[model samples]
Target: MILKKIIEMKKVLVINSSARTLRSHSRKLTEVFVNHWKTTHNNSHITFRDLGTENVPHINENWIAAAFKPETERTGEEKEALKISDIYISELHQADIIVLGTPMYNWSIPSVLKAYIDQVVRVNQTWKLNPENLKNPYIGLLENKTLFVLLSRGAEGYGKGEYNEHMNFQSDYLKTVFNIMGVHNIHVVAIDGTSFDPEILKQTIQNSHQNVKSLIEKELA
Candidate 1:
């Protein structure tokens, strides 16, 4: 009889994209995720990247040149331009799960999070483009990576058939971006109405805790 090998604890990378450090609803929900994860998987390790404090730099001409150039032919400055990107990509590569704690800003994600994404999604490294296939030209390299997104909104009715369904660009945008990166296993938990309605905000947060708890349990189990 052959014995099946049990799965080991997973590496979790937490990316905090909230600009507000002290009083951020997204950050609060993320804490719930992290705490629950730690409790469930005692042996698992956690890596953190707080975009609120460590703002990622946007990709520039030097970065594009370095990324497109062959590894052996890159100059010192070109290599330097890619150093931060390399670090961010390295972190992404090592993680089995990624948690993004983000607050919706003006119906979309914060600029810092976009900057973070730009740094890691490198051409010929993280993904590849095939112009011949117009329908599906890009191929993502990262496989089996899962994403957990905690979104905090200012108002209510952002869900399907809700009052503000068309105004929700945050979750939809993230889904597209991660799908492009080859991550199809995505889970999103939203807590809206923090500033719009007090009662809705309270209830949403309460419901979000339950959702977050169940998500972690499912992952660990």
Candidate 2:
């Protein structure tokens, strides 16, 4: 019932995961996409989280133990972990649309984004294992949401060929991880070759913007 009611409000959250500042190409491209998405989804309000500069701390052994402990046995550390979990869960619960500015680093997503994921993807908050079903491992908690990831890569030819195909753990991993958290529909706009020719970079940005506009129209329709 709550899910049905909350579906009425469409909130979009844009997460900037690159450590770089305004000079970051990935952030610039994602901004363009977000602007276009705003034109179409006029009713949606955007919230931005800069995870690169404000990084989430990694979960340690104590945090892990606290997560598994019964509520009654939880110490002050567990309570703190729960507080952190609540903050992340609240953000996720409030948003209907999620957009991420992810730059490919060493063939994978930036470390900051990965850390943020670790914070948000809690066992009970995002998903739970269905013990009744032996084959089905998880039951998703959140639903009716869309995620758009704008990926920036240094080199071109990552699409189907080029030595970088196997190196694309970024998009594939995001798809798998977010899927586990119950986000079924995901759109990726991979802008490659930021280090390429200047003219090509400008053209790529323009083309990606057009692609995002088309995607927004289709999704909103």
Off by over 4 Å in 1: 1-8
lDDT score of residue 21 within candidate 2: 87
lDDT of 1 at 117: 86
For this target, which candidate reaches the highest lDDT against the unseen true structure?
1
lDDT values, one for every candidate: 0.86, 0.81
Tens-place lDDT per residue, model 2, 19-127, is 8987887798678867777665545577888888884788777678777777789888777866766687788878888888889998898888887888888887798
Q: Residue 108 in candidate 1 has what lDDT?
A: 87
TM-score, model 2 to reference: 0.89
Report the alpha-carbon TM-score of model 1 versus the true structure: 0.93
lDDT of 1 by residue, 1-221 (tens): 11111223578899999989988999998899989877766577799999999958999988999999898999998899999999988888888999999999999899999998899889877788989999988887777888999999988888889999899989988888888777889999999888876776788899998899898777655
